[model samples]
Target chain A: MLFSIHADGPVPIYEQIVAQVIYGVAAGAVKVGSFIPSVRELAEQLLVHPNTVARAYQDLERLGVVTPRRGRGMEVTSQAPTACRSKRRDLVRRRIRDALREAAASALTPDEIRNLVDEELTAVNGKRR
Target chain B: MDPIIETHDLCKRFGGKRAVDGMSLAVPKGAIFALLGDNGAGKTTTIRMLTGQLPADRGSAKILGQDCWAAAEKLRLKVGYVPERPRYYDWMTIAEIGWFAAGFHAAEFYTRYQQWLDKFKLDANARLDAISKGEYAKVGLALALAIDPEVLILDEPTSGLDLLVRQEFLGSMVGMAAEGRTILISSHQIGEVERVASHVAFIASGKLLLTATMDELRQRIIRLKLRYEAEPPDAAVFGSVLQTNGSGKHWQAVLQDPRLEALETLKRTDGIHDMEVSTLHLEEIYCALLARKV
Candidate 1:
């Protein structure tokens, strides 16, 4: 239920919401059938436009990570965690591929690319620890 | 409750000059409403009347559905205010001042006090007089939030803060709004208000100019840049020309309309090579409204 959006970031707010919700589900922070705050409530909480939250919710519902009930608010689905985990893996692979392509274009050696990846991994692991 | 705050033809007169004249507004439960105006546009006078700090010369105001002046003591506990220039006992530390204010409400001072202090990044031991203006503003905000009143009235909460501090204050206010607390903030920081406010009430020359949702306000006013071959297009065809700049080859004007008819009219004019239509920012709308009043 806690999240922050960066206005100056390259990722749009809707995408950020989607990413956070996915992360929350994958991390088991949001359990199945847990009632997420309403779109209006989350929009007010994040200080963003309601439509932006609505767009994120719509995307989440379409992807089967969350389901909206009549008169009730959105709830995480049972399949949400696995779905989010798979999505996260795909996203990370896509980003790594893109970075590798750039490195190749710049004539960076494989060892140099691997060293850069290792440094990033170490930083991520440090944060997690 | 009826409304957290309500006014009926409230007027404040200083000698022959009217600071606030026949101003009326309603703040609904748990909504972040902004009272917007220039420095001398009666915003302060209206807040003073609503908070019962100053009596109105004519008309009436109610806070928490009680008469603001007659029942000032009863309503004081229900409302928490951070004035434009917060004056505290200069000798007190941040913690002492917070606990002193919280004592009035019989609240558990340290729990809410520490939470607010940490959120605002204020040192618990800092003296009120020793901190910078921005840090003092943080302490003022922390004090107000610690009270946990149903209605919060802030007058230019981040008037003197740098960009980062301003963002932090706005973020805190936005978080409070999410908890269903009513807030009425008066500020010249149009962009921040536009981000957090659900409704905006604009005042000019001691009169209410417009009150609308952010979406409605954005839809009402528009910026138009017109490029013509040799002569500038006639502005009369537009609904109301808010501003006009540039000369022969090109010109720009802000137009207000319920629809795009004025834009279409300009597009149909002769020698009009290009015309760009876009939304107006809150500052632009405010400037246009004040100019119209003048």
Candidate 2:
């Protein structure tokens, strides 16, 4: 769905697909049993190798978050929400680690960094309303 | 799964100059392998050897289990080669050439050959000289597929093509790979290759830098920018240091692999204050990698 990828960035294209799909499921943007884009479809859309998309789909299937049908293509499994919730934590942790690293690099004290995080959280929550 | 195409210490020379020197690579079956190198990097030389056009001075090459040089005539029917700049027969119409090549293939393959013509939307009656470069590429592709080749070698198929033509060409390549045909494409277009290639090999100065799945290369290469309170001493904790720039407190180095422990050690070292890590694109990594040889 509404996914953006940086081709020049360090993250591999297939891994990007894996991360975005998990986020899509966790955020309820992708419904259970809904059909995801096939390997050819996504490859044409993303201008990536079809095998890359195939690898991403295979990873999702292996993790029990997606399933393959004989003729209907791949679909988000009913377990997607539950599986994605746990996967989302690790993804979030990696982001936070990078953000914290950046903050420390900026010479900001830990208390000030914590205050900045709180302020950002308040701003995000205010927009959620 | 054995490699459908492979070369062992392949060597070639033109006069006193070495064109391809001790070059070796393997293309596993069903892979879309991108062979990338700068101009004069001997990519064409390597491809010529694999396609049985040029014999190696010292080494050997094989295609689909047959020795390329020893069985050149037999292998030509099996390995389809599309040159970067094809010299077409100006007198023949696109359909005429297709029919000419069709004689070599089975009757059933002609059906698929016709299908490919429709897929490319090529006017069969159009004379070869009247078509655009893109259309000429389609004609070449049509002829290649008409032969029912098991492996396709395309040299710079998308070079100088417009966006739409490149899209169509790439689309056809993906479709071909899906059908289990091994593809070895040589091109300077890193972005396009990154999009459609399952595996990639880098060659420079007739020497191969590396060959790996696209994901593996991305995972191993990285860049680190450091801002220390004082000048930091150089260290080689990772594999190879491709580049190091900046001076005094602000220094940036591109390392092959910046693992956690190596980074932590950099942080733990004296005078280190702040650091940032970034991943490199394939193009940028190749420049850095090739620069070492010069």
Candidate 3:
């Protein structure tokens, strides 16, 4: 899986690694049975502590996103794509919910919030086209 | 598991000044522990004591459960040290120094030293004085790693190196820790430390201010920017406020491990109209922590 990490970001490094792996699987950028970077490899590449990478890998294992295989560091599980799709949706929904909460807190009317969301959605889709 | 390196109330005095006073730390195996502080904050003093180069006047320092002061010679083989200014004989070439250091280690030392030199791309015959500062730093690290020590203690090893060299140095540390080596590095470079260190200890004025895992620090230290209708709530209302800034209805407060109750109370308050809470990077957190003490 290929992803960039922001060392100075608010999100912890390990969480970033876990999220990126899930995102990759969800997007089909990483296929099932393919192995992700080993802890040592990722740590060296990112210049982060290996234990941080290990923690991320462990969390991935617990989430059923990846499994350890003989000689293979961490192979993506068969269920990883489906599992990650739901996880990705939940992650995006949570972010949208937070944005909606902020808009409501700022005293924007429900209709105004709807209009703003629609506007942004159109802008994003238009850019994609 | 027992800590690979530890200090208990370790105190060192120099001419009546307590350089490292009642200091204690526990560094587990495979940890990248960063010791951070301002200049003259006794970081170097503490590192020296841990390496057994300087004796503690009170309490004790231990590495691998052996007394640092008493077992200095025995522990020497198990611990590698790279000082801030690693000075070798000016006329000695890189290869010559490697040969010189090999005398104290097993026969494998020379071979490993050569491998590291090759990896670092240092010319073996380059004299100590002829190499660039970055190359000189790499030489120090290469020599230290040649011993294949279980623990490495570095004092500002990358202080003056360029960005690329510094990144390379930290990358090597990541690989070493993966192999279960404990590393204790004292540095003022908070950004670099944040990237690589699993645990961090902050000291100031000869005393330890805070010690925590990076994850804990990330979870706890928070900066909240609040705008009020009239006047802001007393900064103290936010429990564990480290520092507060801004004036009038606009205010920013950095809180340390704030309680949930305090946040709820702020949300229910009448005057507070808006609040934005964000996590802090290690550099920002360090500044807020030190500024709070001031």
Global lDDT of each candidate? 0.81, 0.85, 0.91
Quickly count the clashes in candidate 3: 0
- Deviation of model 3 at A115, angstroms: 9.8
Instruction: Supply candidate 3's per-residue lDDT for B79.
Output: 94
What lDDT does candidate 3 reach at residue B234?
77
Using DockQ, rank the candidates from best to worst. Answer: 3, 2, 1
Off by over 4 Å in 2: A27-29, A85-129, B257-261
lDDT of 2 by residue, B1-294 (tens): 788999999999898998888888889887899999988988999999988888889988999888999999998888888998987788899878877766777676677778888989999899999999899988888888877789999999999889999988888888778778899999988877777888989898888888888877766777788787756647476557888888656888877755677787777887777777777777987888887767
- The lowest-lDDT stretch of 10 consecutive residues in candidate 2 chain A is A2-11
Ranking by TM-score: 3, 2, 1
Q: Which stretches of candidate 1 lie over 4 Å from their true place?
A: A1-129, B1-3, B107-110, B228-237, B259-273
Best-to-worst order by lDDT is 3, 2, 1
Residue range A17-97, candidate 1, lDDT tens digits: 999999899878889999888976787567765655777899999999999888899989989999999998998899989
Top lDDT prediction, candidate number: 3
Q: For all candidates listed, what's the TM-score of chain B alone?
A: 0.87, 0.94, 0.96
Q: Which candidate gets the maximum DockQ versus the true structure?
A: 3
lDDT of 1 at B219: 66
Question: What are the root-mean-square deviations of the candidates from the true structure over C-alphas?
Answer: 8.8, 3.5, 2.7
